[model samples]
Target: MEDPAQRRVDYGDRSFDEADLAACPLEQFQRWYSAAVDSGEPEPNAMTLATAGPDGPSARTVLLKGVDARGFVLYTNQRSRKARAIAHEPRVALLLVWHGTHRQVAVRGRAEVLPRAETEAYFASRPYGSRIGAWASEQSEPIASAAGLHEREAQLRRRFPDTGSPGDVPAPPHWGGYLVRAVEVEFWQGRTSRLHDRLVLLSRDGSPAALDDGAAWRLERRQP
Candidate 1:
């Protein structure tokens, strides 16, 4: 049975047209993404990342740190549950919804750990506190209490004293980023009636491409 607290409603924001869509999924994604950000949607870059473990599927909200023709990139603790799952099964799914704009994007792709150089570059850009936090968190592991967690963070702080040293904290061995190269991407937009618009772009050679190579993608519209 459905939960009593669950709610359902029809979308009625705007219509979408295939004629107006970009030939490449990356370009189309950029167009909608820019609009979402410019329109001041809350957490415009937030996305739900889903992975499959031995037991079942798990999902969590993650921030989208970078995106380009190659695919979408996000950082996380390499020891986190999601990372563990991805280690066994590299395929993952991502979803992003913009409530105010009544739009959402879904991505199906395979994930690969970013190169050490890329991870280090991003880690270096992090604020001091965030860099320390990465080292302190044993993500998805049990902790005795909040105090215990704080203690570990304090220990990291002392070891890596933010002495304003030119010595930037290095990216921990257990921390890094992943690039999800999309096999398929779908975009949905709300319409006046219950019949909304759904468009999908699929890769031909099953390889990631940059913005300029977007022409290799095939486009199609799906019935809502």
Candidate 2:
């Protein structure tokens, strides 16, 4: 086997300074997000979500569904491990890595359950197959076999009969979304010699302040 330690990547000369940041963290995030998309980064909105509970911390990758002045949003099963963890401890962290762009964004925040209306609207926007799968599989649950899961999906497909209509399948009661109200957002840019650029935006009062409130946040650079 090749030596893993021998693998090296000299991340180019990109630099991120305070002046490069937007008025607020969310704005800065949008700029970076757009750059990642324009760079042809596949699944640029995918992010690692971390939550802690009595058992400990757990993390998984989830696709970002939306973002606004409130923060980032993602959907999942309400009964999943991550959701249970959020119930125990609302505080969570998110990391979005854009390998193609040699950049990353980290967020520390509180996860709040999205309103049913929002969840329903987003769910309705999902592909017909995805809608069926959402109801068929119990996320994070053990199953005897993939066949069994497919069988369950088959049953839902029979019930919903996908006619390419968004209203055909309604959102499952347990399937919903969460909005991460960020207290701190950090942007990182890769540079040579393992010395990266890290600029962090923090809520002045250490709370989840409005993302657009320029006075509510302060930016700081960290040693990299």
Candidate 3:
């Protein structure tokens, strides 16, 4: 009872010339990301984050707060399940898909917790209610009920009335950011006749210099 129309689109027969790609993977990513934004894709910043846990591997969607040559940045509660997984195993992978363009980007990297000061600065930039929620909720922990959460939030609001300024909102110690340093970045483009194009950029020693060398990324075609 499956609908053929609902099946996942298979990207095949796409033509990709490695030479057409930018010398730097970051530049290429930026180009594709900009295209996605221009296409008016909803929540273009949404990416699937994969993390390894004690039990196994898990994946979840999170908004990308920032990106740079070093890695992609995302903010979350330190005590969340994904944060705990990252704490144990810093390695991670991210997947971004823009169905309209039939393009996908996969990134494998190592995650690192940003400095407390940086986390504080970002937290302070958020709305006062969000800051209070950070202090009120014990993320990933089982809650008695939604009412209980509301009560805790109400107490926090009463304890710290917003003064209409960033100074009035303090960062909770449990909230921070994580940066993923990519070692492998793969770009996939869909094509006709099930012939897809895949280009992979992998660093030999997890160093940025490897990407600079022409021989660093071993491009190959994958079966659709």
On lDDT, the candidate that comes out on top is 2
Worst 10 residues of 3 by lDDT: 207-216
| Clash totals for all candidate models | 0, 0, 9
- lDDT at position 179, candidate 2: 96
Distance (Å) between predicted and true CA of 221, model 1?
Answer: 1.1
Q: Could you give candidate 1's per-residue lDDT for residues 87-195 as a string of tens digits?
A: 9899999999997788889999999999999999898888899999999889999998999989999999888988764355788998999999998888999776668
Candidate lDDT scores, in order, read 0.87, 0.92, 0.82
Which candidate do you rate higher for TM-score, 2 or 3? 2
lDDT of 2 by residue, 126-204 (tens): 9998999899988898999999999999989999998878899999999999999999998999999989999888999
Q: lDDT (0-100) at residue 117 of candidate 2?
A: 97
Model 3: runs farther than 4 Å from truth? 1-15, 206-220
For model 1, give the RMSD to the true fold: 2.4
The window of 10 residues in a row where model 1 has the poorest summed lDDT is 206-215
- For each candidate, what TM-score against the reference? 0.92, 0.98, 0.87
